[model samples]
Target: MTTHAPQTPGHPLPTGFPAGTMILTRRGLVPIEEVIAGDDVFTHQRLWRPVTAAMRTTAPTVRVHCASLASGLAATADRPFLTRVARVFLEGGEAGELSSAGWTRARDLAEGHRLASPLDFGKPVPVPDLPASLTGIDPADVLRTAGNMIRLKGEAAAALRPELVDWLAAQFGGYGARRRFPAWALTMPEELRTAFLDGLVNDGPQRDQFAVRMHSKSFMVGLRLLVCSLGFAGGLSSQGRPGKPGWLLSWKREGGRRPDHDGFRWHPVTRVEHGPEAEVFSLSVAEDESYIADGIAVRNRTERLTSL
Candidate 1:
């Protein structure tokens, strides 16, 4: 959800598109069902714009829903992942369990409040007015902790596991409403691109770590921290990043793949802030060569939840 000047009113969807709305496709675009669903979560879409030959994707509002909770049905609270995360604040607990980085990031977000796509901010995006919410927040904390609660047990990340981590990474890893920019827009200076790549592969993939790849290559890999820029969001921008940020890497893969994986790939996508909810973020990916510039892999998505 790239930030729009006057955002549209988004309705709360009981769930995002029914689990199996996407029929099987020869393309690697797997059905949402392919993702594990222990949480009973589902996503449905409200389209604002349709994908066109000129553009790879349509503007749409995706509502993530879970079973409603009632005092009589308090047990249902265990269903949605976000509920569990919020429980930390509800349980009269200090967020000390959050890593120092996490703590710092959150404290920062509390200050500079902003938004991204309509999804990031919630339905009926809030209009950004001059408020303390827009000042002095570390976008890093907001990215790391929002919609996530870290339990300092055995591996800290273990609490979230494949479920929370996978979910968070998907939604927030790439793009949002505030930063209308995407992966393709990350303009790293030439020397920095190589340095960034070197730093990423430094450990040669930790079994417990996360990774962002291109041509099956590990680019920036690690527990990343991010924040949406204050007030200004992407999509509303007239051009890509102010300067080219990273080296363009082109490649080819013969087997199953995504368009973004084609001779199309970019590193360190852009991040910006826009909506009332700075959590609203956006990112763009380069298209695969075969699919042309506008391909599915190169498309953008809005994440409702994620952890830095």
Candidate 2:
């Protein structure tokens, strides 16, 4: 007779499988199952390769406090609304092989947690004097819109909106809702804010001037969303492992009022990729030339691209 290890309720292979596992790799936190022997895992200042390893024991399950996890998650500047538990990979000190330190829910990661730093192959990288900034745009608008889009997909995803709203409220407080403007928008220079509003309501050279400035802000915001969505989708696709290919995803904004010629509006475009293997999926959003150009640039530079 053959004997097998006891499996977790929702996972395959009972005790030994690395399902929902995350490991600190050179790229970032990747699933332990996805890790290859030569992959570089992180330590404080050194990189180590995981050659061979096995799970020896399983810890007794403990009741995790949901409120604690939620509060800890709230502190994150970019807290994801959805989450799940996964096995995390951590460095085993000076040891070369990676270890499945324990199982942790992604939402439960707290402030003091450390991740392996990515290895740069002995190159002198230039450190910029000033940090990059995404200024003058209201992130709440983007987040709210994104949340709504997810929510409208129906009950299967109904929880997303409230989660995002609660997280935003925690981060920015009631001020934004009370003022009816995004926190960042409220902080804009008086002249710039007035100009932006005027550009929305009026036309002519003055509107054009303000529109140009406002559009610059919009472009930055859109670019940020585009980049973030791509990363989020790619990461969610199991780091593009074989048989688990990743996708390049994007969103479009559509059917909104256009205030001025250069006013930010979402435009729609359809693309078909012809290849030996192809699949069709669709999503809608609005756009302008700047966003279109940026989208093109992103697609040109990426693989397996898809838009929503």
Candidate 3:
């Protein structure tokens, strides 16, 4: 039987939605499972609340094959594939207006279909265009770490050790001619950088050789560390290299250990196999440990788990 770790006192699992399960409500796009009957869902640039909720059997179930064209292009060119995903759907009432709306899949969502947009004084607003490419780092961590440093008083921020900052900067700043620095690392103020790195080093077991190695150099590595630090499992993958170099970072989940104790663990994906279905993959961590993503598995390994 699988056992779950006891909840930590001060820390909680990060909030997120399962793959392929988000709904557009007055608050913007949220996981459909998270929606309540009274919550306002977006329809025709207006808010509509559900009166009754029921699950009924239907003749044909909808499925979408939403592909990141960019990632597809990169896969063809033999580069890292970074397409991430989450589930989204329209409620029954919202679907009535569309011609091919019933059981419509994400790939089928087209122009004229209204989705819940972020609100400005209860009025739906247009969604903004996002950058075609992202740096593969979680934006939340960057904002939180920066905010923490900014909140520190003059002496506290300035008192950080110089050597620590230099070491961190070197690791994230890149080592050779072809290397590129993380955008956050390049833009962060000197004092903030010092404080951020110092917090991670001092928060937990810095003596662990594996931990040191995992947290060193790569901004992506540090981002994984940050995700694990926040008490969630993080999966990393790259194109061409399936498992050897990919990292699975997570805190201890089953042991009865102190929550504050930073027991970060790292594993390499030894193997990756295509699932019986399309857009699905199974990852092997060890002889006895494996997890399925985007498959029939009820529980997923990671929120952003994707094929490489």
Candidate 4:
């Protein structure tokens, strides 16, 4: 009697496949956003490509990844056409032919973040020889309020409140509780509290025989969407394989740069300010109609040349 070998089973492999997908997060392990975005993030690029391709094709994935820094995902995973368009990123697909352009935009944003203050994500990226600081506050602090400052001010997300920063630090500190994801619960089922507690310490029961599986199956992938071609998502550099390095922008800073006009604040590098009354000091700009009209003439006579 010809009998096929009995299928070895756990989470039984789909026969003819159930149109499955493979996911990877933390490239396997998971951690905080800043840590993941640190200098050594590129350590696992080859592995992520296949995983990202799975995201494009699979039903969905919910994952936490500092590499991209966002979570909780749905909806976009089923975009049938997206798979067709992004086939090049997937395995058994076409990662080889796309050329550098496929990843150019992502890499550029990665570089920009790196250019900002390496110590703090809050600072702006300085421009060469331009007088001014990129940012005056910590990026972790500023990130919270960045959105609120613009559109959702006064909401929970706005970084304006100091409490938020503290809370973030507590959750990511490694031993504290994370009300949101609760690291303890991931290892065992959420329903059991004692088991989670028993495993909470370093290399405790929580680290083995229980830690929930880690993955980039969905959430971190969603971050990729938000950051697409938009520059860094207002955060730190993403350590990815061959991911570009951060940068710094600096230029000369002389006094009397900022200026005010018609109730508007014009930047200092571009303008100079003069005060009103007696007249109070105000900002002014170095506008040269002549230069605009005739670039060749200015280039020929300028005593100092600088790159803007």
List TM-scores for all candidates, in order.
0.17, 0.20, 0.22, 0.16
lDDT of each residue in 218-253, candidate 1, tens digit only: 111001101111111111111124342221122111
lDDT of 2 by residue, 1-308 (tens): 21212322543211111222233333333333444444454322222333222221232221111211110111111111111222232222122232322222223434322211111212222211111232344643344343342223334333544434443343322321121112232223434333433322333223222111111212222222222222111101111345443222222122212111111111111111111211111111112100011111100101111211
Q: Any runs in candidate 2 off by more than 4 Å, and if so which?
A: 1-18, 46-48, 56-58, 63-308
lDDT of each: 0.20, 0.24, 0.26, 0.19
- Predicted structure with the largest TM-score when compared to the true one: 3
Model 4: runs farther than 4 Å from truth? 1-79, 82-141, 144-162, 165-219, 229-308
Worst ten in a row by lDDT for model 3: 68-77
Q: Least accurate stretch of 10 residues (summed lDDT) in model 1?
A: 68-77
- Rank by TM-score, highest first: 3, 2, 1, 4
* Candidate 3 positional error at 264, Å: 44
lDDT of 1 at 129: 25
Model 3, residue 304: C-alpha shift (Å) = 34
Pairs of colliding residues, candidate 3: 19-87, 20-86, 20-87, 21-87, 22-87
lDDT of 4 by residue, 1-308 (tens): 21122223433221110111111222221221112111111111111111110001112221111212211111111111000011122322123222221111111122111100011111122211211232454442233232222222234333445444444334222211111222221122222322222322223232322211212222222222222111222221222333322211111112222221121111111111221111000001122101100000010011211111
In terms of lDDT, model 1 sits at 0.20
